[model samples]
Target: MTFLAISGSARRASTTTALLRALQSAATPAHTITVFDRVGELPIFSPDRELPSPPDSVAELANAIADADGLIVASPEYIRAIPGGLKNAIDWLLSCDALIDTPIVLAHASHRGDDMLGQLRLVLGTVSTRFNEAMFLRVPLMKKTPEEIARLLSKDASQTELLDFLTRFAAYCGSAD
Candidate 1:
């Protein structure tokens, strides 16, 4: 399965982005995980601007999502809520057919951010029929450097967990098809 792992952080050195990158590295050859860490590049969504067609960057994101078998989203909590950039990306996809039936799951990078997670669950569930609320992976890698995250996730135990999670999610996505 090809999964688009989206990072919801705008910061260059974000733990959320690092976590997605780690997942991308851990994925097996059969399961291609593409990490999209550029939500910050998408233009602010506007309904009027979407009529003629959305921006090039937004279209590129939509195309990537369309090509993927499933989506894995990781984000950081901001002000006890979803980050604006991530939400804006979702808004751009709201009217696009690519997201309506796409399978989606959440992978949290922090031990905290339950608030943001809850809201993401609600939003994603609303947007996509195949959003798997029951399938989740939460690794406590907050405040860790990218090097530290890579080292930690490269361990045998962490690799097992990541592979297991991907296997189950792949099955779930297959079932939907």
Candidate 2:
């Protein structure tokens, strides 16, 4: 199975990215996980630009999501809501059909981002029919380095939870076949 993981933060060293990296490492050899940490690079979404030809970055993001068997998103909460960059990326997909039935799992790396998570869930549920509310994972990884986070994920308990989530998502994706 192929999983596409996206990090919503644009910082050089963000907990969101660290969590996604740890997820990438935790995946079994039988699965491939690709992390896309370029939410900052995507152009601001506009319906006008959607008509003729979307930007390369937008097109690339859409194509990547379309090709992946499943998607995982790790986003940091900003002001009790999803960050602008990540929300912008989702907005770009609104005019397209790439996310119609794509299976998605959401992860948040904050101790208190339930509000943002809820908003994300509502938005994703509205946009994608296959958004799995049951596959959500929340780990308070703030202030931890990527290596530390990866080591934590290597622990038996953490690994089990993550693997179980991935396994369930993989099964959900397979059901689409």
Candidate 3:
């Protein structure tokens, strides 16, 4: 299975991105996880641009989403809400058919982003019928450097948890009913 993991943080060294990257390494031979950390590169969405075609960045992201078997979104809380960039990326996809039936889940890098998580769940559920509200992975990597996070996630216990999460999500994606 191929999964697209999107990092909501645009920081040069986001712990969320590190967590997703670690998941990439922990994936088994039967699965592949690709991290998409360029939400910041997408221009703010507008209804007017949806006519002829969206911008190249928006098209690229939509294409990736269309190609992936599933999506895993990880985001940081910003003022108790979803970060603007991640929300913008979703907005850019609202009219696109890529997300309508895609299997999606959430991975949380911080233990403190429940507020953002709630909002993200609501938004994603609205956009995709296959959004799995039940399957989630939350690791408390907040305030840690990306390097530290990478090392921590490399530990045996963390690897086990990540692999289990990926396996469950992949099964969910492949299930017929």
Runs in model 3 deviating more than 4 A are none
Tell me each candidate's RMSD, in Å, in order: 1.0, 1.5, 0.8
The best candidate by lDDT is: 3
lDDT of 1 by residue, 1-177 (tens): 899999999899998888788787888899999899999899888888897788899999999999999999999999999999999999999966668999999999999999999999999999999999999999899889878988999999998988989999999989944
**What is the lDDT for 4 in model 1?**
97
Q: Which clashing pairs does model 3 show? A: none
Winner on lDDT between 2 and 3 is 3
TM-score quality measure for candidate 1 = 0.97
> 113-141 in candidate 2: lDDT tens per residue?
88889999999989999888877788888
Give the per-residue lDDT digits (tens) of candidate 3, residues 50-111.
87998989899999999999999999999999999999999998866778899999999997
Query: In candidate 1, where is summed lDDT lowest over 10 consecutive residues?
Result: 17-26
lDDT for position 39 in model 3: 94
Best by TM-score: 3
Better structure of 1 and 2 per lDDT:
1
Cα lDDT of all candidates, in order? 0.91, 0.86, 0.93
- Whole-model lDDT, candidate 2? 0.86
Residue pairs that clash (backbone atoms under 3 angstroms), model 2: none
* TM-score (C-alpha) between model 2 and the true structure: 0.94
What order do you get sorting by lDDT, best first?
Answer: 3, 1, 2
